[model samples]
Target: MRALVLDRPGTCDTLRPAELPTPLPGPGRVRVRVEACGLNPSDYQRAAYGIPEWEWPAILGLDVVGLVDTLGEGVTAVGLGQRVAFHGDIRERGGFADYALADATVLAPVPDGLEPARAAALPSAGLTAHQAVVRRLRVGKDDTVLVTGGAGGVGGFAVQLAARAGARVIATEAAHNTDHVKRLGADAVIDFRGEDIAARVRELTDGRGVDAVVDTIGSDSATANLGLLVHGGGLAAVAGRPDLNAVAPFGLAPSVHEIALGAAYLLGDHRSRVQLSIMLAELLEMAADGRLDPMLSRTVPFEDVPGALVELSGRQVRGKIVYVAS
Candidate 1:
């Protein structure tokens, strides 16, 4: 199998093309013949600073859409040749090659007529947004929700899902993506580069603050958003950890939800891992019916994975990028 192999943790230059033995599925796993793999910021992060549980010579492409070639022993849910998409576990070698392995529990069949590249864009980002908005925040009708990075992969879906749930969606993006995020169901778009996001959200909510905030761009953004929520409102963080202490003095009773889609695999949380597949199925159905957009902005040939990682690491990508198998 031809794979972009990472022998050591470093920059994108550390990735090199090599013909490696194709991986086979072990018990309770499935081997997918790679069709498309999506690029994500986490890909570059893992490549540059390795995961604590990951081994050397890793392959890093997390959002994978492909056909199941073989099923390991005791796997009864999926069968051979079924087209599937899943968020590849980063602790294992990922989908950046001709064949990739996954636990069968995580596979969701790609809806008919959905393009592989489009499906490839969904699993990780879509799952995160779904879990944050639907499961954690429970965004509902007439509620005002704020989504940071609104034009981004996860934020785009968060906007749509919140809107579909009858919530008024507020999103933050670069000035240029204001129109794009609006089309994705964001009722208001704030330009984080130039505008005061907190002030704008207050204005939009008439000084009440949002019912909940889905924070995709974490770090300081997460902590800042805590102050923009109504008392008892939720904030779901997908990226970095937010300082809960920031809201301590206010006694806002803010609901802080930590969303880590891959943590289910890391902590051996079987129930949450199973819910990932359910979330993928629901997301794929929405995409197939046009209720959700994969937000795929670019499709490149598989060999461009290395350069694509470099491009993604730059943090200028507005939407998802998927690389198809040659």
Candidate 2:
């Protein structure tokens, strides 16, 4: 099998194509003949910063859509040649290759007629947004929600989902992305670079603040947005941890949710891991029915994986990028 192998913990330039023995599935696993793989910031983050537990020579595509080629023992849930999609475990070899491995329990069937690249784009970003907006924030009718980094992969989906749920969505983006975020159903778009997000959001909501905030760009953004929540409102942090101390003086009964999408797999929690599949299934259904946009903005050939990762690392790409297998 041909794979873009990471020789060591380094930049995307270190990724090189090489021929390696195809891996066989262990019990409860299946081999995926990769059709498409989505590019994500985490791909470059892992390549550059490296995970403490991950071994060297890693493959870094996490969101995968492919056909199940071979199933291992006890893997009766999925069949050979079945098309499926899943967010791959980051600790293992990923979908930036001709083939990849996936746990049968985490495989979600890709609906027929849904493009592989579109399905591939949904596993990670879409799932994170779904978990943040739908599960954690519980955004609903008449609620006003704010999404930081609204043009980003996770943030874009969050804006759309919140809007679909009848929430008045406010999104923060650069000036250039104002129209893009608005097209994604954001009722109000704030220029994060030029304006004060909290003030703008407060003004948009008539100084009441939003009912919930989905913070995709974390660190200071998370902490600042925490103060933008109404009393009893929720803040779902996808990137970094918010400083609880920052909001202590306010007496705002704020709900803070730490969203780590991979924690379910990392903790060896079978139930939560299975929930990944369930989430992907629902997301796929939404995409198939035209209710959700996968927002796949670019599709490149398989060999462009490394360059695409480099591009993704630059943080200028507006939407999801997927590399299709030839």
Candidate 3:
């Protein structure tokens, strides 16, 4: 199998193509013949900063959409030829390769009617959104939610999931992505660079602020979303941590959450894995029903991933970029 192997961690030029033996599953695992792998922020983070736990010449992708090719000991729930998707420590031989071994428990059968690229996007971002809303925040129907970077992968899914549950959502994005955010179900879209996000969210909520907020950009934007939380509201961040002092002015009983979907999945917890699997299944259903969609900005062939990673590191992408495996 051919894969993008990291000879050194920092740049695209260092990712050289190499031939390696196709990996097979071990105990309670399954080997997947990968059809697609979704590029994520974490991918570039690892590529640029270097993961200490990451082995050299390792494959760096985590999101996998593929077919079950072989089963290891104790695997019985899913059979050969079943289509599935999973996210985990592809840190050894990540999903960038044509074959990956995953714990069977980590994979969920791709729900009927879901496209592979779309399915590819669900494991990481969609699961993060689901966990934020359902597990951590427990958002309700009447909630007014605010999402920073609403046009982004996790934020985009957060917007839709919140909207689907009947929450009125407000988003802060660049002017160029304002319309895109609105189309994804935001009741109001504020251009963070130009508009006062906290103020607008306050006005939309009658100076009461929103019931929940997800800050995907983290630092600079955490204050904005924290300010928009109504007293006693919930908050979540995909990118940054909230300063408890900055959140004090809101006078709300604020609960801040950090979403580390990769680490969460890496725990190998059965309950969390099962929950994520169910969430992925429902996310796929939502996509097939048109209630959710991957804002696919680019679809490149597998070999182009190295060059694509260079762009991803610069943080200029608008939506999910999938590698269409040949």
Candidate 4:
């Protein structure tokens, strides 16, 4: 099998194509013949900053949409040739190759109408959004929620999921993405480049601030989102951690949460894995029924993985980019 392997943690140039043996399923695991894999922030993050746990010549990718080629012993829930999507572990084998190994317990069966690329896009970003908005923040119908970077992958899904739950969502995005955010169900869009996000939220909420905030950009944006919440509201961040002092000035006493979907799926407890599988299944069903779009931005063949990594690292992408397995 051909795969893009990182000889050592470095730039995109370090990711080189090479012939490698296909991974086989172990006990409680399954070998998937990968059809499509989604590019995520973590992929480039590992490339830029080395992951100590990932050995050299590693295949780095997370989301996998493929067919179950072989099953390990003790796995009877899914059968051979069954279409499934799963969260690949970079610490083990990943989806950048022709075949990847995954724990059968975390696999979700893909519905008939969902394409491989779209299904591949859902596991990481969609699951993160679901966990952040639905579980961590506990957004309700009458609540006003603000999503930072609402036009991007996780943010887009957050907007949709929050909207689906009947929350009035406000999103921070580029002026060009106004319609994009609105289509994802944002009740209002703030042009982050030109507008004051916290001020806008205050104005939109009649100086009361939002009931919850899903912060995807992190850094200063996460700190800013902490201040934009109503007193005693909730917050979730995908990238940055909130400063205790920053939240102190709000008088809101917001409950801060860090959303780490990758860790939960790859290294979490049994209950976490069950919740991830259930969310992936629900997301797959929604995509199959045309209720959710994975927001597929582009599809590239496997050979172009290096260039794609560079492009993704530049960080201008609006939605998910998928790689079709060769």
Candidate of highest TM-score: 2
Model 1, residue 71: distance off in Å is 1.5
Please report the candidate that would top lDDT against the real structure: 2
lDDT of 4 by residue, 1-326 (tens): 88889887788767888899877788999999999999988888888877778766788888999999999999999999999998766577588899888888889999997889989988889998988998888888999999989988899999999998899999999999999899989999999999988788889999998889888987678887777878898989898987768765647778988997767655688787777788899999999998888899889998887788788888778899999976
* Cα RMSD for candidates in order: 1.3, 1.1, 1.8, 1.5
Model 2 agreement with the true structure over 178-233: per-residue lDDT tens digits: 99999999998999889988788878888999899899887788998888888899
The lDDT per prediction is 0.90, 0.90, 0.82, 0.87
> Each candidate's TM vs. the true structure?
0.97, 0.98, 0.94, 0.96
Look at candidate 4 and give me any clashing residue pairs.
none
Give candidate 1's error at residue 217 in angstroms.
1.8
Worst 10 residues of 2 by lDDT: 48-57
Residue pairs clashing in model 1 are: none
> Could you tell me the TM-score of candidate 3?
0.94
Could you give candidate 3's per-residue lDDT for residues 263-295 as a string of tens digits? 645565787677767777777777777888777
Sort all candidates by lDDT, best to worst: 2, 1, 4, 3
Better of 1 and 4 by lDDT: 1
Which model is ahead, 1 or 3, in terms of lDDT? 1
